[model samples]
Target: MSSSHDTHAAHDAATSHGAHAEKKSMRLMLHVWRQRDPSAEGKFVTYKLDDVSPDMSFLEMLDVLNERLIAGGDEAIAFDHDCREGICGACSLTINGQPHGFESETTTCQIHMRRFEDGQTIYIEPFRANAFPVVKDLVVDRGAFDRIIAAGGFITARAGSAPDANALPVPQVAADAAMDAAACIGCGACVAACKNASAMLFVSAKVSHLALLPQGQAERNSRVLAMVEQMDKEGFGNCTNESECEAACPKGISVSNIARLNREYLRALASSD
Candidate 1:
């Protein structure tokens, strides 16, 4: 048997080490959605990650987990992320029932591990919607958004160079409104946040951004019509004005844009006559 002095020394050392470890790192219980493919059924799988640095971004934490998984001969969790600077809306994850992890004006890649409590359970999953089918574990096909943009989200007016300052002068209010709408990165968070899976917020942002500008006048009517048509054809649910999308938007996109979309649609219909 160990001597009493040795036992006391070992116990003190262990207690000190535990305190140091607790102060420097964190342990998280992650309930992540696992899916093999689009057709395969997905379910939540628990994973315990230890020694996590609070300074690490959410994606970095995932990176550490994936490194361990790869070394352990387990399939790594697949998640989308790009421009970890948060410019790209590629980090389309729903964290703890909130899109982009409950941060105001932020993306998933911008989420820091420090926001979570030590040993707290985190629920991570892909953006759910009929239009956004799961491609793999935590990866969903957001190509539907690209299609909507391609349909009529551009202006055909050729711009060889910057226009003269006085040329095509726009109202200050309209210019500011257009810029605000243009901030949308098309991350599809609005759709994920809505109970009905509506893409109105996304569509409205695009429409409002262009429609408020003078250059966009040429195709304003057709733009709204074609985009809305394609949106419906893609199986996105209709907006019932629940405003869930606005609350969940990372860019703080307002629901007023949806109202603008409705007005634009009606105006387009009347112009068709």
Candidate 2:
């Protein structure tokens, strides 16, 4: 409705505002773990960042650090990230001793630099667990999770192609529970948070999600048994009921799934005997 002159002026104003916003920055200190590889001795190396943007996500801040290191002819810090929007669960840094930092119900990639204070020293480390050994700084081998899932996290039923939602006839409660357990992203924050580095939370979610559904009934008992057995064989420790796993989970996956896993394992054991 306006003249072309007014439109050009508005565009100029918006561009100026965006340029101004980008100028805002923060200073921070980072004590990041540095290890050449699994066999190398790891240590925390301090780096001072003078121009961090509050608008940057946590991973973006790391990207900036890597750029600076590359410019200085130094090896960049190694880390994991995929689908920076948080669905893939690949950003696995233990920031300030908290998995995914201070953010609640959010992944590390979803955490903004604004959550930190200016001039604060942040400690970053890879998720620590026997099953999740560090491959490099802030990157651990999560293949143990893949192995557990492969053990029996699925149904062997011959039910071909996906069925229509209405044909399933699943109860609302059961469907809701299944969907809730299915939300797990397999981030291993549970193992990192547990004192014993236990993977019960992760294993349980996989078990409960399928077991609660009718399609999972045929292999439910064996599924739990196989997954739990693999979880132990991977050198992961036992859950002592400390519940730190639930607290660190970005999805807030309930520990009640762990209890269901215990029951399923018991049932499987009794029947086998």
After TM-score superposition, the amount by which residue 12's alpha carbon in candidate 2 deviates from its true location, in angstroms, is: 23
Model 2 ranges with Cα > 4 A deviation: 1-23
TM-score of 1: 0.90
Displacement of residue 208 (Cα, Å) in model 1 is 0.5
lDDT of 2 by residue, 1-273 (tens): 112334553454456556654445789999999999999999999999999867577898999999999999999999999988778988899999999887777899887776788889999999998889999988999999999999985676667888786987889999999999999999999999999999999999999999999889988888888999999999999999989999999988999999999999999888953
**Tens digits of per-residue lDDT for model 1 on 107-174?**
88877776788889999999999999999999999999889988886687767799898988999999
Weakest 10 consecutive residues of candidate 1 by summed lDDT: 1-10
Q: lDDT score, residue 233, model 2?
A: 98
The alpha-carbon deviation from the true structure for residue 148 of candidate 2, after best TM-score superposition, in angstroms, is 0.4
Model 1 C-alpha lDDT versus the unseen true structure? 0.87
Total clashing residue pairs per candidate?
0, 0
Count: clashes, candidate 2: 0
TM-score of each predicted structure versus truth: 0.90, 0.90
